[model samples]
Target: MIGYLVLALLGLFVVAFYAGHRRAVASVEGDVARLHSRPSQHGLYLALLSCVPALLLLVLWSLVTPAIEASIVRARFAAEVAEMSLPQVQAFIRDARAIAFGGIAGFPDETKEAAAALFGTLHGWSVRIAVVLSLALAAAGYLYGIARIAPAFRARHMVERTVRGFLILCSVVAILTTIGIVLSLIFESLRFFQQVPIYKFLFGTHWSPQSAFTGAGAEEGAVNTDIFGAVPLFAGTLLITVIAMLVAAPVGLMSAIYLSDYASRRVRAVAKPMLEILAGIPTVVYGFFAALTVAPFFRRSGEALGLDVASESALAAGVVMGIMIIPFVSSLSDDVINAVPQSLRDGSAGLGATKSETIRKVVLPAALPGIVSALLLAVSRAIGETMIVVMAAGLAANLTINPVEAVTTVTVQIVTLLVGDQEFDSAKTLAAFALGLVLFCATLALNIIALRVVKKYREQYE
Candidate 1:
């Protein structure tokens, strides 16, 4: 029903646009030069007036309808719900809604069937009320806006102001969302800190949340704070990120240089897209390749070379993650390198420099900031990757830096802690938020450092 109303509003908006456009021309007897704004601006203003208010009404209606329906159903079946707990009441409402909407319900009884029937009736009435009121509002807004269209009307100004306000609202929303996330992480991490000290999480050597006190009511269960030591997780994350950068940075940078300076147009058109296809492949598929192919290949090769390699090792995950990030680094670096003015290369040639010398001495220095930024961004991507790590690097949480050994990153540990139904108040689950907070801080710091590096090099180049 709501979808139908939205489609109707869209149609009305289109009609309003053409109507306003014609009205603007008709208002001034086809003397568009006398009007303050263009016919298109008038049309846009009318369209926004027609649909914006109706869209807001529909949003409000959608939020209110479920609550209103749940209340009416509960009041009608008061006797059935009187003895139920809050969760049970919520469950009953859910089941009734599901049954009314042709969804599969958990437990459908005669009481629930009656509730579902009532729910369907209420939903129909509510949708009718919403549609009628929304359409009326849209019609009224259209009439008012059209009536206001005159020779002196500033439709462009009004439309611009509305768009500007919308952009500001979007920016505010993004900032607030970031602030909210950080605050929530801090709040949850503080709760985890109450269970386990911050110092232990920061400095202790071991990483074993499985043995930590995770039960809600068991006071007798040993709360081993030392097991929550995150040092090993940090080491594993650093090890993997370093390995990934080792594989990605030089190779991606060299490929970008080749593509930007050496490759012909024909070669670039084919090679660049083929290289970028790596980035388009799903990370889960990369994880599978890492697990099934890369890890096993490494293990077999290790045996041949008289080396011991874990079946699920950090080396495999890091290498595959590096492969995944190659496109990101290569694309960014290629664009940056290409952005270096041709005059710089021409000047270098005028100085009797060879192509290799000009590239090494001039082009690379000019593009260093962007190249560094790309590599840092790739590092951030590597640090956040969980699938490849989870599949290739086993959840051993070993404090070793050996790439051939099994190790888990901070992201993997965070995921491991939060999987399935969890008691949020327990140290185990809260630990995920704690790890998240640390990761967020680390990423933010990395970005700040990258910005500084970019600024410094950019100043020199400029």
Candidate 2:
């Protein structure tokens, strides 16, 4: 019903726009120059005036109606609901709503059925009243807007103000959302620290949160401190990220340089897209390629050389993950390199520098800030990647840096720990949030590095 009402409002706005447009034209007597605003602005102003108030009212009604209906139903079924706990009563109300819509998840009493029928009837009447009121409001707005559309009307100014207000609202929402996420992470990490000591969690060698009690069953100091150690996870994450960067940086940068400086127009057109196609391929597909192809190939080659290689090795995962992220680095670097002023390259050439020297010393230095930003972004991506690491590197949080052995990343562990309907209050589940905090900090550090890098090299180019 709400969906249909929204559609009706949109249809009304469309009609109002065209009607207002024709009325504006008639008022101007085909002399558009006489009007302070264009016919389109008049149409837009009318549409907004007709629709915005109605939409706002509709949203408020939608929020209030459910609470009002639930209150009435609860009042009618006061005796029955009073016997249930608050949570149970809330669940009962949800069940009643579901029953009213003709789907029963479970059995209920006759009083509940009576309540549901009354709930459905009340809800139906409310929808009808709301829709009628909405149309009336829109009609009133249309009349007011049409009367206001004169030779001296400032539709464009009104429209611009409305748009600016909307933009400010969107900006506030985004800022609030980021603050909320950061606060949630901080609060959850604080809870986690209360259970496990921060020193042990951050610096201890092993990670076995499963062995520790997660809730009130835990005493003030009863939790296993050793198992909560996060050093291995952090180590594994850094190792894999470093390996991925080692693979991505040179290859992506060289590709960018070649494409920018040497590749012909026809070749660049085809090759650039072909290289970027790697980014479009799903990471899960990359995981499969890592596990079945890269891992096995590495294992066989290792065996031939009489070296010990795990079936799922960090080398395989890192290499595959690197291959997956190459497009990101390459694409960003290519754009940055292309954005460097051509005159700098021409000056370098005139100074007797070869094409290679021109690119290496001049273009690259100029594009350093953007390229550094790109590489940092890619490193963040690599650190957060879970699929390829899970499939190729295996889920053992090994502290060693031997690429031939298996190691798991923080992201993979977070996923593994939260795979089922586990109690979130448990230490094991809360560990995911802790890991998330660590990941957040790691990414934050990378961003700080990017800023410092840009600050350091950006001035040199200028």
Off by over 4 Å in 1: 214-219, 457-462
lDDT of 1 by residue, 241-262 (tens): 9989999998899999999999
* TM-score (all chains, Cα) for each model: 0.94, 0.92
Candidate 2 lDDT over residue span 1-462, tens digit each: 778879988998898889878888899798989999888889999999999999999989989999999998888888887889998888888888888988874667787688788889998999999989988998899999999998889999998999999999999999999899888888888888887788989999988776675534556647665688889998898898888989999999999999998999999999999999999999999999999999999999999999999999899999988888899899999988987888999999999999999988989888988899889989999999999999999999899989999999999999999898988776778888999999999899988997787666556555
* Clashes found in each candidate (C-alpha, N, C closer than 3 A): 0, 1
Model 2 scores worst on lDDT over the 10 consecutive residues at: 213-222
Q: Give the poorly placed runs of model 2, Cα more than 4 Å off.
A: 102-115, 214-222, 451-462
Name the lDDT value of residue 384 in candidate 1.
Answer: 92
Error of 1 at 162 (Å): 1.6
